[model samples]
Target chain A: MRIGELAERAGTTTRTLRYYESRGLLPARRAENGYRTYDEGDLRLIQQIRTLQDFGFDLEETRPFVDCLRAGHPAGDSCPASLAVYRRKLGELDALIGQLQSVRTEVGAQLARAELEASAELPGGPEPRCELGPTAPQSPVGPNWEDER
Target chain B: MRIGELAERAGTTTRTLRYYESRGLLPARRAENGYRTYDEGDLRLIQQIRTLQDFGFDLEETRPFVDCLRAGHPAGDSCPASLAVYRRKLGELDALIGQLQSVRTEVGAQLARAELEASAELPGGPEPRCELGPTAPQSPVGPNWEDER
Candidate 1:
């Protein structure tokens, strides 16, 4: 199919399809008029690409999986390397969850403190001391006090 | 005090102090040599700026808070606007936390499903149509299926 047809079928923009091609995630053969031609397998590949992206895998990370699909296996069992890829992605997801959870906890604590102080009617003086003390820690809030103040 | 002195006292870079001045987050007077000078109160303002930023307020959002501080509240209780600013920041933090939490849930579910599928041994041949269905929902593991197929 043509780029437009593929894009329409895949529910993505032609620009995105082009980008995937440029990133080597998709390979297309050129026709006589320089139009890109795609096989039925390309449709499956595009679906896979979309699925991986939804799962938070980047184009670079999806490359090995595309290669495996193209190789055509008689059985559903995949390459051992593919299993490793899934494991690595799982680890990354866990780390991301951990980081976000920490941010949520810290922000929740800060908001609670702010509410406490606001309700107490305590004369807001300089925070009893820096809420974040010496030795700054990484927080999703952005650059730490070490960089800010 | 000179910009350098203010930066040293505030534990911030001179460039950041200047950037804040340009952004109207900080006010400074230019001396004969065209050097920026700040007062003792500026140090407190810088500390407050850092505090707001730590709470996830961007430089733009901190403007109202800076203005409130500059207006000179008789006491911390005097600036009702400051409390509003904190409330606004709290809302933004809550939304951010909600977003991260949603993403974490989706990614965590995908990871669990991938692990389960990876460990299961499938019968050789066309995948059987089971209650779970032949076409699994598109997931990060889908693209990697190339490696598995």
Candidate 2:
């Protein structure tokens, strides 16, 4: 199929398809007229790429797996290098999850603080509080030290 | 203190401080020689800006909150609009976390599958399990079900 057709079928833009091609994830044959021709394998590879990207693997990191697949290696028995790549990706994902969890905790605490301050009447009057503005003191230096070792 | 001093104390580059000034996040007074002068409050504001950025808030989104603080309004109070912004940001973070979690699960599954296949050592020589090459099997219809879905 043509580049446009492949892009339409793949649910991505032609630009993205070209980018994947440039990244060595997708290979296409150039026609006499210079049009790029892609086949079913290209489609499957694109699907795998999209699925992995949805699952958070950056394009650069997904290349080895794509290459292994293209080389006719079985899914689970592909290149040992691919296995190493997967391990590295797993580690990165773990780190990302830890960071996100920390951020979630901080945001939750901030939300609770906002709600608490919102419930109290401001000193001036019944006007809605502007706790997010300048006058509010910085969050207490640290959470209560009771849990500290 | 001057911009250089503030930048040094804040652990940021002078270029970044200048960028913040250009972006209206930091306000500074111009001296006779065109040098920028910063006060203690400005330092505090810079610190707060850094903190907010660390918390994943973009400079544009932090602008109103910074402005309220600069104007001496109560900082912690919930401005409905700012709260709305916070909610939007939280939603984005949640979506990101969900995506990362999904990716983690998929990667884990792939790793398990790879390990299992590696251990099995099937009697038959390896054949390409999935059509990942250009000439691989073509779907009768358009793209694969995963892509269409």
Candidate 3:
């Protein structure tokens, strides 16, 4: 198949396929007219790359899996190199999640503190409403505390 | 105060202050000697911008808080516009955390599946190690599934 046909089959773009080729993840043979040609094996490698890409692997990170597939492995992760990449990515994702969770906690605290200060300045009837418990003043507007963008 | 003093007081760099000025976030006044001049209020605004930056806010997203502080509010989130930015950021953070969590879940599942597949390929004597149970078949040599590469 041609580049366009393979890209169509992979549900990716020709540009992405070209990028993968540039990175040597997917090498192709040339037709007589200088067009990129692919076979079922090539398609298999591209599919392996695409599956890893969908799992958030960078192009460089997918190289090991591509190499494994090119080495005739039954699956991409059938090799140790690919498994190492998966392990590295898992650690990075875990650290990223921890950082984001910490940021969420801090940002939530700041939002609560700012809201409390804002409400305290209002013309409440001085019921000792500051630095104390809240009776849930002013029905919430805009996005709620648990809302997502 | 001079640019150096301002940067030092804010625990940042003159390059960063200049970048912020170029982005029109923290414009500085020109001294008679052709140097940049700053005041305490400018310092306050820079601090506000820094706080938001620390909270993972983009420079553009910190504009509302800067504007609020410039409008003489007690704090950055003291204004409705700043509060709206907070709400928007909260929504964005929530969405981002949600996406990362989903990715984490999928990556974790992939890791587990790949580990199981890798372990199953060992030279065990085929003692019902098909897909059901694993009674410590082979001694681990390469990266364990529990190991973070």
Tell me how each candidate scores on DockQ against the true complex: 0.08, 0.21, 0.20
Tens digits of per-residue lDDT for model 3, A1-149: 99999888888899988877766678778999999999888888888787777767878888777767776777777767777787788888888878877887887887888888877777674543222112222235722323122
Off by over 4 Å in 3: A124-149, B125-149
Ranking by DockQ: 2, 3, 1
Cα lDDT of all candidates, in order? 0.64, 0.72, 0.75
Error of 3 at A19 (Å): 1.3
Place model 3 in a CAPRI quality band: incorrect
lDDT of 2 by residue, B95-115 (tens): 888888888888888888877
Cα deviation in Å at residue B73, candidate 3? 1.2
- Candidate 2 on A37-56: residue-level lDDT in tens? 99988888888788777766
User: Which candidate has the top score in TM-score?
Assistant: 3
**lDDT (10s digit) by residue, model 1, range A1-149:** 99999999999989998888776678789999999999878888888778777766788767656765665632111444445556676677666656545655665565566557655654665443222211333245743223333
Proportion of native contacts in model 2?
0.37
Predicted candidate 2, C-alpha RMSD: 11.1
> Which candidate number has the best DockQ?
2
Weakest ten-residue segment in model 3 chain A by summed lDDT: A129-138
Each model's number of backbone clashes?
A: 5, 14, 0
Name every residue pair that clashes in candidate 3: none
